[model samples]
Target: MDTSTSKVYHVDGYDSRQYLEHYFSDKPDLTFKDDTLIFPIENLTKIFKKGHIKGDLMIDLSTGSMIHYLLPSCEFFKRILVLKVKDRCILELKRWLDTRTGAFNWGHAAKLHVDIAGNSDQLQDTEEKLKSAVEHVVKCNLAKENMTDPIVLPPADCIISAWLLDNVCKNQDDYIRYLRKMSKLLKPGGHLILIGCLEISYYTVGKDKLHAFSYDEDFARKALGEVGFVIDDCKVKKRKAQSDLADYKAIIFIAAHKVK
Candidate 1:
C-alpha cells in the first residue's frame, strides 16, 4: 500500500492490470482503445532515427508507454534491457512481447530481458507469468531484479527512459544519483534519450491523488551535463487533450549523449 516503494497495488484481489483498467475506465481523457497510447509515434520515430540506435545495445530505464512505441524499431539491437520500475509496466511489456502479432519482431536475434523491482510479490511467480506470455520463438530471459540495488547491467550503447526521472526521484540529489547510475550502465560513448513530463501530476497505478516533482527542462539539461553528458538535441512540446482537465501542460521529448 506504500506508494514510495511498492510498485503495484491490488484492489479487491485483482491484479495491477485489472486495477488500471478499472481506474481508467471512468477517466474520459485517458483512452487505451488503439494498440498505441496517446504520445505521437511519428515524433518518436524521428528521434530514434536521429539518435542512430540501430545494432546497438539499448537499455530502457523506465519502459512505460515507450516500450509499446520503441520495441519494433529496436530489432537491430544486439540486446535490449528493459527496466520497469513498476510491476504492472513489466507485465504489460511482457504481454506485448509474448504476442505473435504484437510489435515485437521475432526475426531479430536480440535477447530481451525485463527487470521489475519495488514489488512485494514472489520473484519466481513474476518470472513465470512473464514466461507464459512469451512466444516460443522469441529468445527472451525474464527475471525480477531490483533497480535501487547494485545491478550488473549490460554495456549499453544507448539508454532511453520515458517519463521516468520525475516519478522515481524525490529531489534534485536523487535525480542526479539516478543519472549517474544510468551513466555507469552505458558504454563510454553511449547516448541517453529521455522523453518525460516537465511539470505534471502523478496519475498511474490507481493512485489518482498522488503528486510528483515539478520537472524543469533546464534543470534536466544541467543534470545531464553534470553527469558528463552533452546535450546533442533537445525538443519540448506540450501535449494537450480536449477531455483531459489537468492544470499542468505536458512537456515531452529530450535526447542527450555521453561525453567522451
Candidate 2:
C-alpha cells in the first residue's frame, strides 16, 4: 500500500466503537495490555508521582475514545479537558463517561492502572477519580489557528497527546505545524507528555487502514526541539505483540516542558 494513498484519519474519520473494541476491549487478549497499556501508565505514574508535571489543568488530545490513558493522571491533576478532532469520537467517549448502555467496558484498564500504582485495591477509586477530573470534551480542528475556536480554553499547565500526530501529520513539516498548535495550548513552562509510534505508516481500525507518519526517534527529538519544547524524558519500547493491526516497530513516550 502506497503511503500517499493511505486513508487520512482526520479527513476519512474513524470507526470509534470498532477501534475501541479492537484495541482496547476487556477480552482475553493481553497483547494490547502488555505492549501498549503498561508503558504509558507506567511512565505517567512515574512522572506524576515524582511531581515533575504539575498544575491544576491538564488537556488530553489523545487518539480515539481513550479513557485508560487518563486513569493515572486523575491522581495528580485537578481538571482534565479532552479535545477531539471528530464528533463520533466525542460521542463514543461521552457514552463511557456518562455510564450509558453499550459503553465499552474499561474495568480491565482500571485494574491495570491500580496494579501499576502498587495499590491493586484502588480500581474503582481510580475510575471515579478520573470521571470527576474530566470536566469537558470539546471538538477541535488542528488546521485552525485557534484549534478550540469560539470555546476559548485557558492555556493549560500540561497537555497529553497520544498517537494523534502519527495519524494526523502527512509529513515532517505537518508534524511540526501540528506540534506548534498543541504547544500554543500550553502556558510558558508548561509540560507536554506526548505518546506516539516510531516508523509506523499505517494502522488498521476495523476494515479501514489509516495513514501514519513514519518518523524515527531522531526526527521526533528534532521536532520537539523545533517547537520550543525542552525534552526532559524519552522512552521507547519495542513492539512486543506479534499482530497485524499496525506496523509500528516501537512506541515512544516523551515528557517535555515548554521553554519559558
Candidate 3:
C-alpha cells in the first residue's frame, strides 16, 4: 500500500475523538506508549527540572486536541497558548478543558507522568495543572504569515510541536517552511521541542488513512539547523509494537533552541 497517496492532515477533515481513542487509550499499543507518551513525558520532565524551558508563556502547535504532551510542562510555564489547525480540534480541547461530559479521559497518561515523578498521588492534580496553564486554544492557519492572524501573540519562551510536521509536510521544503513559521513564534534563545515519527508514511484515524512525511534523524537535524535552531538533544526509539494503525518504524524527540 502506497501511504504517500493517503489524505494529508489539516487539508482534510479529522476526527479528533477517534484519534484519541485509537492511539491514547488506556491499553494503547505498547510502542506508542513508550515512544509517543512516555518518551516526551520523561524528556519534558528532565528539561523542566533543569530549568531551561520555563517562562511566562509557551505556545503549543500540536497535531490533534492532544494535551498529554503538555502534562509535564504545566509546572514550568505560567500560561499555555495552543494553536490548532482545525475547529474540531479546538472544540475537542475545550471539551476537555471545560470538563464537559463525553470528554476523552487521559487518566492513563496522567498517571504515567505522576509515576515518573514518583508522586503517584498527584495524578488528578497533574491534569488540573495542565488545564490551568492552557490559557487559550485558538484556530491557526499555517499558510498565513501570522499563523494566528488578527491576534498577534507575544513571543513565547518555548514552543513545542509534536507529531505535527510529519502530517502536514509533503516534502523537505515544506518541512523547512513550516518549521520557520514555528521558529518565529519563539523568542531568541527560546527552545523548540519536536516529537515526530520517523521513516514511515501513514496513520489510521478510525477508517481514514492519513499521510506522514518520511525522514531520518539526519534530515531532521539538518532541517532544524536550516531553520536557525541549534540542536540540544535528540532521542530516537525503535518501534516496539507491531500494529497496522501506523507504519512508522521509529519515533524521534528533539530539543533545540532558536539561535539569537
Candidate 4:
C-alpha cells in the first residue's frame, strides 16, 4: 500500500452539506445566478455544442458531493463512472442517487439543472437518467499506479474533473502528477474538461482549514499541454464571495484532448 496516498483526510467528518449550500445551492433563487455556475455551465454548453464531448464512456475523476456538474452533460455518455476520495462524499451522493429519505435535498440543484439545460419538462426524466447512468462510485488514489483498484476499467472517451486538483493537491508538482494520472484514464483523442479555482491556497470545511495549491490559467494551460494534452480553449469566470467558501480571484475551465 502506498503511504503517500494514505493521507487520510478527516474530510469524511467535514460539513459537505453546508459547503454545497455556500457554493451551489439555488435555494436563494432561480436563473443559475451565481458566478460559480456561470463559467462551468456556459463552457460545458459550448463543449457539447462543438461536439467535443460525446461517446459511450465518461469518467468522472472528481465526484464532489453535489451532482450539478453531471447534469449539464452526462446524457452525452452511455456509461458514467464516478470516483471519490472520501466515503462521506460517496455516502452523500448515494443518498441522493438512491432517493433515500435523509438525502441532502438537491431539488434546488435539479431546478438549476433544468435552468442550464432549458428543458423545463425534462427535469423528472433527467433525475431518473442520472440515477441509472452512474455505473459506480468507487474510492480512488491519484498517487497510485492504478487509481481505480480491483475493477480495471477500459479507457474513457471523456473525463470530467471539477474544482478537483487545486483543492486536493498541496503544490505544483503534486498538481501535475495528479493531472498526468488522470490523463492516462482517457483514450487517445478523448476529451478532458477541468474546472478549477484560480489563485487560491485554502478552503474551509466548517471550521477546519483545508489547504489547496495556488495557480493561474497560464500555468494550468502549460501543465496540461506538457502532459500529453492538446489545448482547446480556456475560460475564466470571476466573482466576489460573500462567505469564506474558498479564496480565489476566478474559476478556470479548461478543455483539452489527450494527444498521446
Question: For residues 171-243, could you state the per-residue lDDT of candidate 1 as single tens digits?
Answer: 7886788788788778887878776667755444443324445668888888889989987777766654432
How well does model 2 score by local distance difference test?
A: 0.87
* lDDT for each residue of candidate 2 in 43-81, tens digit (9 for 90 to 100): 888888888787899999978998887888977789999
Pairs of colliding residues, candidate 1: none
lDDT of each: 0.52, 0.87, 0.88, 0.75
- Estimate the overall C-alpha local distance difference test score of candidate 3: 0.88
Which 10-residue span in candidate 3 carries the lowest summed lDDT?
A: 24-33
Off by over 4 Å in 3: 1-5, 28-31
| Candidate 2 local Cα displacement, residue 219, angstroms | 0.7
Residue-level lDDT of model 3, residues 1-260, one tens digit each, is 44445787789957998888777777644436777778888888777788777899999998998888899888888999999999998899899999999998988889988988788978868999999898988999989999999999999999999999999989999999999998888999999999999998889887788988999999999999988999988888889887898999898999999995
Give the alpha carbon lDDT tens digit for every residue of 141-243 in model 4.
6657788776688999999998778777777887788888887788999999998888986666555556667899889988998899988888888755554
How many clashes does each candidate structure show, in the order listed? 0, 0, 0, 0
- Candidate 1 stretches greater than 4 Å from native: 1-40, 63-66, 100-151, 204-207, 242-247
